[model samples]
Structures are given as C-alpha cells and as structure tokens.
Target: MKSIVPCLWFSDDNCEAAVNYYVSIFPNSSIESMSYYPDEALDEHFIGKTNKVITAEFILNGQRLMALDGGPVFRFHEAVSFTIECEDQAEIDYYWEKLSHVPAAEQCGWVKDQFGLSWQIVPYNMGSLIQSDAQIQAMMAMKKIIITELENA
Candidate 1:
C-alpha cells in the first residue's frame, strides 16, 4: 500500500475513460481496482448516475493515484499539476504531443489535457537549466520547452 496517493475528482461520468487514457500514456501503469456506488446509494443520491464509478485506483509511471466521480462540486486547477520529467527532447515532445489539448493553457512547458488536468513536460535537468540567466528568458518565450535552446542559452 502506498503511504500517500493523489485523488483526482472528476465531475464527468468518464472516470474509467480518464484512467484508461492515463494508463495508456505512462509506462508501468495499470488499473489496480475499481468500485461503484451501491444501488441504494445511487438511487438515493446519484440519481441518473447508477453504477457510476465511485472510486478507481490506478498506477501511472509507478505512482499510485485514485480517481473519484465526485460530481461538479470541485474542478481541476493549475495550482495542482503533475510533472513529467523527460530524459531528452524526444520524451518531452512525446508527452507534450500526447497530453496537451488546450493550446491557450500552454505556457513555459505547462499544458492542460483534455480532462482539464495540467501537466508540465520538462527535461530532467530543468532545474539546473533554469538556473542559467538566458535559459529563464528562453523558457518564457515558448510554450513547450526546447532542450537545445536551453542548452544554447
């Protein structure tokens, strides 16, 4: 059992779809388990959402996460985001291409996926690179980070 895990609340009824999408994107990932709202509870509270996913436990890139179909009481925000540390430009490009769905939200290597989850596709050495004077300016100029440009900067 994981000591701590991130729980994502989904307003939509597509929690399974979202889990599958994330499992497909990351390596060593799989759906660990799933549970649905009881019929009595569903009838009493969920209304039309019968048999809907109440919670789903999954692993993404070896990290355990839980997804909850919690209705529209809450929403995802940029304040909470997952960072994908890429080994090189290829990995960065791959994650960016697969995860980025909202163009307007793309900025400084950060992107918002179709499910409104924000992700940062960054090179593993981004910390050191950002420490350089010119690299900071170069990063600010583009949405997706270019490793070569950072190296040059």
Candidate 2:
C-alpha cells in the first residue's frame, strides 16, 4: 500500500460503480475484490438482507483507491477533490472524458460523478506557473491558456 490512500463511502451499488469507473480510466487498473452479503444471516432481522461488502479495492493510474458500501451518511464534494497533475493536454483530456461521465458536470475545470465525487483535472505544472506569477497579466495569460485548451477539445 502507499503511504496514503483514498477511501470512499457510498450507498447501495456504489462500490461496484467506483470499481468500474476507476479501472476504466487507469490503463493498468483493475478491481481487486467484490463480496456481496449472504442470503442467510445470524439474526432474525438480518436474514436475507444486504448488510455490507467485505472488501472492495481498485487501482487508478497505479494509485490504490478503496471503496465501501457504508451507506449515505458520508458524501463526496468539491470541498475535497482529487487533483491530477497531468503531463500534457492529452493526459488531461483523457481523464476529463473518463471522469466526467456525467454530461452536466463539465464546469470550472471540475466534474462530479454519479456518486458525487468531485475531481479536478489539470495539467501537471499549471499550479506552479500560476503561483510563480507576480503580475496580473501573467496569471491572466495562464488562465487563457487553460481555457483555450479546454475549448479546443
């Protein structure tokens, strides 16, 4: 495992959804495990009901991401987004298409999944370029470059 990994909680079939999504995007990615609740249970109330997924894991661009069917108490939002520092526009474009499956989510360089996970797709050195700028015109130029790239797609 890496020093840190992202764990996402979802409701119902969210585990499956996440697996399908990330694996499809990352070239060498694949689902590791998927376990469903058993039909018979220990308790009277638990009988024939789905309780939990034993484990669910997948790899995205060689990064490990985990998911669980832990219900809707927790959710994904823009407040916590995963940023992809892509090498070039092609890399950004590839992620943009794979991650932004939701048609209405293409906005402000951010996109949301059906499960509401927010992701920021950007070029690798874009952030440093913006931070290094001391002049307003320089920042504007950088912004224009990103917008132009996005538009050209």
Candidate 3:
C-alpha cells in the first residue's frame, strides 16, 4: 500500500463516475483499480452500497487517490482542497473549465468540482503577482483567477 493516499468519500454511491470523471479531466491520469461491493451486503450499513463500487484507486497527475461509495454519513467541504500550480493563464483556464462545477462555491482561486471536492487553480507564483493590496482586492472580486488582471493590478 502507498504510504499515504487521499481517500475521497462519495456518499452518493457514485464512486465510479467520480473516478472516471477526474481521470478524464486530468492529464497523466488513469484508474488503477475498482472494487465492487458484494451482491449480498456483509453488513446492514452496506446495503445501500450493494452492487456499487466499494472503492476505486486511481492516479491523477501523478497523485494517488482513492474514492469510495461510502454512504451519506459524511461529505466534502471547503476546509481541505487540492492546489494546482498553473504555469500560465491557459493552464489555469483549462483546469477551471474542467473542474469548476459548483457556481456558488467559487471565490478567489477556489473552485468546487462535480464531486464537491475543492481545488485551488492558481499561477505558479501567486505571491509575487499579487503583492500589492490592489492586486489582492482584484483577486478577491473574481472567481476564476485572471493572471493578467492580477499582474496588471
């Protein structure tokens, strides 16, 4: 087993869809394996997961992650997120287009994906770009980060 892997919990029982969607969006990504729940659930709590995906292991942009159909006991929130260091506006835009799903959750450089996972799509050196208060204010006003605007500010 990998020393450490971020496991994603999907209370919706759509682990397969979430894994496939993420792999499709990210480059250098692939589904390593997917284990299905037994037809006859081993426990009463697993009844909802019967015939569904018990877990899926995958690699997204060289990062190993596991996703599971862990019924509605928990959910994804904004406290934890993945950060994508983009080299340019195009890279940021590409990831934004593919990952931003929840419109209301957008702020600064944070975006929520279809699976409710949060992601920070930003330039490689955002600190150097948004050094001034003006630039910080400019970034705060927008959802998808505009590198040019931040630099100009």
**Candidate 2 lDDT, tens digit per residue, 1-153?**
547878877765567767787787778788877776665555674344464563588787788878877665677667888887777767777777677756565554576766678787776666554443343244343421363433333
**Each candidate's lDDT (Cα)?**
0.91, 0.65, 0.91
Indicate whether candidate 2 or candidate 3 has the larger TM-score.
3
Candidate 1 stretches with Cα past 4 Å from truth are 40-42
Off by over 4 Å in 3: 41-43
lDDT of 3 by residue, 1-153 (tens): 648999999988788998999999888999999999976656776565667888999999999999988888999999999999999999999999999999999999999998888999999999998899999999999999999999899
Candidate 1 — which pairs collide?
none
In candidate 1, what residue range of length 10 has the lowest lDDT sum?
A: 40-49
Model 2 pairs whose backbones collide: none
TM-score of each candidate? 0.94, 0.71, 0.92
Provide the clashing-pair count of each candidate structure.
Answer: 0, 0, 0
| Candidate 1, 69-101: lDDT as tens digits | 998889899999999999999999999999999
Error of 2 at 81 (Å): 1.5
